[model samples]
Target: MTTENKGIVQRALAGLIETGDVNTLASFLSDDFLHHRSDATTSTKAEWLAAVHAALGPTAGMQVEILHLLADTDHVVVHSRRRLPDAGPEIVVVDVLRVADGLIAEVWEIIEPVAQTAVNAAWWEPARL
Candidate 1:
């Protein structure tokens, strides 16, 4: 059952990013869900939905890649990747989630910027110090 929940949770998150469908996402979330962002800010379910709407702007093109998944009872952890409309690709995003009463009740994430050595090594003149 936990495995099924994990799959459901992951799919819901993916759908949220893909379609910017707040309603669909909300159905799977607890009202008091605790969300810990990769940037370290915590928010409730309402806040998260608002943030997604703001980020979507007039065009929605965000994409999510689920690299791996692990489930332990009501807890689900995922290593994932996301691509934003105007942002470069990043890697190593870890999301920890808790599901209760058939809804996602808590979530935490850690994200890291992808090291772009090629871009970094490009010849771009730095400002005079």
Candidate 2:
């Protein structure tokens, strides 16, 4: 079910940050997996792993906190916030993923700096209506 796919994403994030081993995520990703980033960059599984390695500096030392997760059929969306150790401000990330055969086939992610004054709002919020 879609909820299980959300768990897959959770596991993948934890695996990536905890183990820093791309192969640890094999159970979650399909061989043809594709990741689409906020910058509009698209990459295959290998390419994405390479990028992750470079960005996270080999060990990929990081931690993630899930703020929200939503699943609709084959689509899963996750919103998380995390901060590097004394390095920079907190970063908020929104990841949208598509799962097939119980594995992630595609992903799109939006990353942004969390503004100190920014308040979380929902589209259906009464004030926004």
Candidate 3:
């Protein structure tokens, strides 16, 4: 079940990135899905899908690279980097998804913009021995 949950999320994310099809992405989500953002705001399935469509509909060159994926029981965690069409700084995102009955029921996401100048190394960078 853990593998299945991971596969479901991977496929959903792949579908969104590859085709930018909100409808296809919607198929993987439950009707009562809720999205919890890092801003302390939450969105329902409809609102979330609408935002996704608005964001992806115009960004044909947007890219998302998955950095790591881990699954335990019904939860799947994904760490990824997104480069939007605006050519701005890349954003690092970590999404935790709860899969229920083969569909994504809830999602919690944290986003951070990459800094051009930083005092320390990026958290995602490989550490030197």
> In lDDT terms, which candidate is top?
3
Model 3, position 116, has a per-residue lDDT of 46
Model 3 clash number: 0
Candidate 3 local lDDT, 15-108, one digit each (tens): 8988888888999999999999978999999999998887665455667899999999999999998887767678888999999999999999
User: Candidate 1 residues 5-86, lDDT tens each?
Assistant: 7887877777776677777888888889888986779998888778766654336665667788889888999887767666
Please give the distance, in angstroms, between residue 78's alpha carbon in candidate 1 and its true position after superposition.
Answer: 1.6
Instruction: Give the TM-score of each candidate.
Output: 0.74, 0.75, 0.85
Provide the clash count, candidate 2: 0
Model 2: weakest 10-residue lDDT segment is: 115-124
Error of 1 at 26 (Å): 0.9
Please report how far candidate 1 places residue 20 from its true position, in Å. Answer: 2.5
Clashing pairs in 1: none
lDDT of 2 at 107: 88
Instruction: Kindly report which residue pairs in candidate 3 clash with one another.
Output: none
lDDT of 1: 0.77
Model 1 segments more than 4 A misplaced:
38-40, 56-58, 87-91, 116-129
Model with the higher lDDT, candidate 1 or 2 = 2
| Native-to-model Cα distance after best TM-score fit, residue 29 in candidate 1, in Å | 0.5
